[model samples]
Target: MKKIALILLVFMASAACKTNPFTGKKMLNFYGNSQIFPTAFAQYDQFLNQNKVVETGKDAQMITNVGQRIASAAERWLSANGYPGYLKDYKWEYNLVQDETVNAWCMPGGKIVFYTGILPITQTETGVAVVMGHEVAHALADHGAQRMSAGTLQQLGAVAGNVAIKDERTRNTFNQAYGLGSTVGVMLPFSRSHETEADRIGLQIMAIAGYNPDEAANLWRRMKAKSGGQAPPEFMSTHPSNDTRINNLTAWAPMARQEAAKFGVTSFK
Candidate 1:
């Protein structure tokens, strides 16, 4: 049984490896991009049809404008990094919904929805760019794909472990091991890395889009205040803590500004 378990683990580890595009880190991602992209596109369309998508107007126009700038920045960054036409599969669209929820999200295929309540906090076009760039960075970095891959491995490991164990005590031990390995070795660090990468890429994108990267720090301050000090610690949540995020963004802003200078955006106001 021990030999069989060890062999299975070895196979799983060998079969699940991938490399993160931005960080160049070796990771375990079992899902293929070809499989995930089409499904994400279909889901995005379905969501647009079902939701109250805002039409042409001030708020709607602002969303679309900021989204386009960010999308252009992403395309430029990818192309410069030798991934030309990387965004060909993306059908980007942005909308502001009438809801009061202070929430926003960028879906897998570049669909973005910004709830009206978030606008008050965003305050200006640059602030909106900060939030939109961060959300868009998540999609570009393929964090969703990584998360799905991690979930698949966790499920498969549990099933294999259950099949290998005979006694209830051994089964429980196997289950615990599977859970700990999946959560600690796979999920937690991956999530934190994604958050940090998103902040880095998002700052660059916003700066290239002609929005001041400094706004990212202020945006997180607003997010923290809006949360009323009610969020879980950085380790316990998918997002970094407010202070950590703000500090990281502050440190990265000058670098982003430097990168933007190469793109003819010397000043962002």
Candidate 2:
């Protein structure tokens, strides 16, 4: 049973790979847009219905405007790079929700929400572009589907271990060790890599949209300050540390600007 399970896992992984055009890397993704998008859209609708969605306000309008521009930039980049229909399945929607969470997020198929509390950090429209770009990048990269795929594989690995171990005590021990080891060694690092990828992609798209890429790093600095230096160690955390993000964004800003120049955008906002 264990051997069969291992074989099945390997087969699935080999067959379920998709190439991410932006990164030009093949990633494991068991779920397709058809399967993930509808569910995400439904959940997003439910959340908006449950929350206080600010429909008529300056901040709300700004969120929509920045989101549309960033998304358009991404589409332009994709079309120019030979993936003309990459975003065809994506139904883009952005809304501002009245909340104090100090965060924003995007669903799989371009559903985005900005919490009111994050406006202070994103003080200007350019600053808002920084955050909007990051969130949109996650959807563009299909990080949510990748994460689900990874989780499925992680569970299968544990199941294989359990089936292979004959002794009950040994099986229990393997489960505990596998849970911790897989999370820290594989899952956490995977998540961190996704975050880093999003940051880089976001910077490029925001720049193409005539927003300053340098502000990406500055946004992270403000994020660090807001966190009060309280965060888990890098290895244990799902996202990269604030300092790491700041440094990465700073280094990538020039390249982003170069990319924007290809689209005839030289002056940033």
Candidate 3:
């Protein structure tokens, strides 16, 4: 029985192995792009058809323009870095939805939705680019896949630990303890890393798209100001603290600008 179980575990692990493109990290991923992308695309289309998608105005046009530029930048970077046709499956679409929530997100398969309420804080095309770039970076980096991989590992670890323990009551207790430890120690840090990486990559993408990387810092400042001191600390949340994020952006901006220079981005002020 134990031999059979071990064989099964090895097969499962082998099936789940994947290599991350951006970080080059070997990870366990049960789902592939072929499975994830189609689901995301369908969900995105359904969302647009159900929502009040803004159209026929300057604001709408601006959203589309910024999205297009970022998408172009992503394609260029991917191809130059040896991921030719990386975005061939992407059916990119951008929409501004009429909402009061100051939030935005880009789903996998290149669907982006920006809430109108965020525009006031974004304040300019550069600001919008910063936000859009970050969201797009998340998709481009396959952060969603990373997240799912982490979750699967956690579940498998829990099950293996429980099996080793043997006693039902003790196994339950161990599982509970493991859950708490993983949430605080592994999950939170993993989420924070993704956020920081997104910020760095986003800055570069925005610069490559001909938007000023410097605007990234200012955009965070505006986001902080708009929050009115209500956000949680960086350690406990998925996002970095405003100050920490801004400082990191400031440090990374020069590098992004230099990268853009190679692509003829001369004036990023």
Candidate 4:
């Protein structure tokens, strides 16, 4: 049983790998768009039905406008880079919901929601672009499916361990250590890497869309201030520290502009 589980895990990892065009890196994603997108779209629709989705307001318009620009920029980049039709399967939808949580998220297949509470932090269209690009980047990179794949492997490992270990005490000890080690040492870092990847990719796409990439770091600064500097240590947190993000975005802004220059977007809003 243990050998079979291990073989299955290895086979899935090898067979399910795909290359992400933006970063030119291979990703492990067991869930494909055909399997994930319909579920995501239905859930997004259900959530909008249950929530106060602002459909006819300045905020709603801005969300749609910015999201469209970001998505277009991403598409342009992909096509220019030889990945035309990469997003053909994506059903992009954006909505603004009346919620107090200072959060915005993009589901697989480009479903996005912006809570009203995040507007203050966004402050301007460019600020909103900063967030929109990041969310879209997550979708473009298939981060959701990759995380699910990682979680599946994590569970498979636990099961394999239990099957292989005959001593009950040793099995319990292995479970405890594996749980902590896998999360803190592997899972958290994996998530943090994804966040950082999104930041870089988002910066470039937002710049290509004619939004000032500099505002990406500024947005994070505002985010840090809003958090009152309250956050877990970098190693333990799923996302990178605010300071780290600010620094990375600051350094990457110039390069992002260079990327935009290729698209003839010399000035930004």
lDDT of 3: 0.84
TM-score of 3: 0.90
How many angstroms is residue 27 displaced in model 4 relative to the true structure, after the best TM-score fit? 0.5
- lDDT minimum window of 10 residues, candidate 1: 1-10
Which has the better TM-score: candidate 1, or candidate 2? Answer: 2
* Model 2 spans > 4 angstroms off: none
Q: Write the per-residue lDDT of candidate 1 for residues 103-220, one digit (tens) a residue.
A: 8887666777898889988999999999899889888877787777767667766777787778999899878887887787767877888888888988999999999999999988
What CA RMSD would candidate 2 show? 0.8
lDDT of each: 0.82, 0.96, 0.84, 0.96
- lDDT: worst 10-residue window of model 2: 8-17
Query: lDDT by residue for model 3 over 145-194, one digit each (tens)?
Result: 77887787677677667667878999889988999899888888888888
Instruction: Write down the TM-score of every candidate.
Output: 0.88, 0.99, 0.90, 0.99
Question: How well is each residue in 31-135 modelled by candidate 2, as lDDT tens digits?
Answer: 999999999999999999899999997999999999999999999999999999999999999999999999999999999999999999999999999999999
- Model 3: how far residue 63 lies from native, Å: 0.9
Model 3 error, position 205 (Å) = 0.9
